[model samples]
Target: MALGAHRIPPGKAWQDPAVVFAPSVLRLMERVTEEPHPDYVGLLSGHGASRPGRVELSARGRIFVGERRYPKGSPSPEPETFMTTAELAQKFRANSEGILAHECVEAILEALQGLEKVGDIRGLMRLL
Candidate 1:
């Protein structure tokens, strides 16, 4: 999905009625000024294309990840927790710090290529 394309309607609650976000995902949502990317929404909303391993969100805001689904009206299991901030930072540093510069350049190039593909010359020029 294009960056910043998913919008939470004005004055509407951010949470979709049909799905609940994991706590870590909620934290990330809180930090962002703009709406999340559609890919994130898809993953959190349990779209078949983007749902991660065994992750699912029920219509009643229950989260399930690689666990048995409880019967309707039963008590829900706790959602899977993502890494804490410190753990995430440590993992990022270990796995991504070394290639951060290269990745940034590659991302920019990819975005520019996308803009060009769509004949968005003004957008492409703004980046350059």
Candidate 2:
């Protein structure tokens, strides 16, 4: 996001869903990785290549890295911005369907709506 935000084309690399695996981007990464490093190095992984991928960047000594995490079939061009509150709730409900009853999901949603009124977090944990 930061890279795309700073690019002359504001949505060039990070925002475009297709760019996640663009050959140019991968090539650039390969070039960077091939650069001579005297000490440790870093790598990038999880750029919509798999479900529940991680988004992180870290380096060791002379290397640098970047990574990304996004669920499969998730809309792009700012996927996080595409979900509505109700849609998020629906997703939550769907994911919890087998582990939690519909009633429990509804109760949890309601409790979250007025979370400030919750007196005890244990009360909510019990539901889970």
Candidate 3:
């Protein structure tokens, strides 16, 4: 569980090798699975009852949620009510900085936004 912490909150925990491989941490994970909360639903609620692509799991008392694709032909009820460009840009910046350098990320974003004007594909590759 700790090994994949980067995929969720407290995102950089995977970088610390000692913390991830600790015996105490492994014990905690084992205990959680063995004695999950009484009210834990641990259900994946998306698309429909028969076809749920997203999943949520509760261990001990912690709630862990993840999502991927929804079923085809089944759109979100409020599809038109989505994040604004500013919100998307904020999320992009947060996630991109984890792997790419800040300046390189900004450059790549700019290149993506201006792709139509680029005369050479190599220009985009250079930013990458």
Candidate closest to the true structure, highest lDDT: 3
Could you say which candidate leads in TM-score? 3
Clashes of each: 0, 1, 0
Q: Candidate 1: which pairs clash?
A: none
Order the candidates by lDDT, highest first — what do you get? 3, 2, 1
Task: Please write out the lDDT profile of model 1 over residues 1-128, one tens digit for every residue.
Answer: 11111343222233434323545545655654433344565554653223323333333577543432332223334233334545444444444334566555454456644654656566545543
Give the total clashing residue pairs for model 3: 0
> For candidate 2, which ten residues in a row score worst on lDDT?
37-46
lDDT of each: 0.42, 0.56, 0.57
Candidate 3 lDDT, tens digit per residue, 1-128? Answer: 54443244443445567777677767655644333433234333322322334445776899777654333234445444355656556666877666778988787777777789878889779767
The regions of model 2 sitting more than 4 angstroms off are 1-80
| Model 1 CA deviation exceeding 4 Å by range | 1-79, 100-128
> After superposition, which runs of candidate 3 have C-alpha atoms over 4 Å from their true positions?
1-19, 22-24, 34-99
lDDT of 1 at 65: 33
Clash tally for model 2? 1
* lDDT, model 3: 0.57
